[model samples]
Target: MSNISKKNKGYFSEEIVKNYYINNGFKFIEQNFTVKGGELDLIFSKVGSLKFIEVKNIDGINDLFDYITKKKLNFLIKTINIYLYKFDITNIDYSLDVVFVKKNEIYEIYDNIGI
Candidate 1:
């Protein structure tokens, strides 16, 4: 698919995952939080724990790792830092999580896939 088509699919998947989290009692904080080099697909909070989520629309399990590369992880960390500083969030406890969506269903939810 083209970039636009792929992006639209990604957005749709993000929405699906957003609702999935909300249904599970997580409060939505933000979506599509973007900086120069990367974007946070979703931000959520529950019981004082904050989560920075990356959403992927995948066709197979292997496709999920394609999104988790060294460069991408570094960029994601930098983006999270920028988000925390810009929003003045300090020492609040956070994690980097990934949610994989296939079509309209959630394929898998992985928490704290850190490098």
Candidate 2:
């Protein structure tokens, strides 16, 4: 796909993921959070824990292995930290998660992969 097509697809996938999360009882915090060269697709709270969610429009977990680069993970981690600091949010557990959407199905991985 072209760059523009890919970006629009990505944004649409994120919106789908966000809605799925919300329907499943997650509190939506923000979407398309950007800071400098870093960005996080979704930030949410669930069962007293804060979730930094990365949505991937992939078939499965294995498909994510090649997609989440180390550099991108570093950027995401730094951005989440900055967001926490900027908002003065503390005293709650946090985790990195991925919501993989394929067709009409949704699969979630909670702190399963390091990135």
lDDT by candidate, in order shown: 0.87, 0.78
Superposed model 2: Cα runs more than 4 Å off: 1-4, 59-63, 103-112
Residue range 17-66, candidate 2, lDDT tens digits: 88877998999999988999888899999888888988877644575557
lDDT of 2 at 91: 86
TM-score of each: 0.89, 0.80
For candidate 2, which ten residues in a row score worst on lDDT? 106-115
Instruction: Provide the lDDT at 86 for model 2.
Output: 90
Clashes of each: 0, 0
Query: Each candidate's root-mean-square deviation in Å?
Result: 2.3, 3.0
Residues 13-84 of candidate 1: C-alpha lDDT, one tens digit per residue: 999999988999999999999989999999999887788999878776665677688888899899999998
Q: Could you say which candidate leads in TM-score?
A: 1
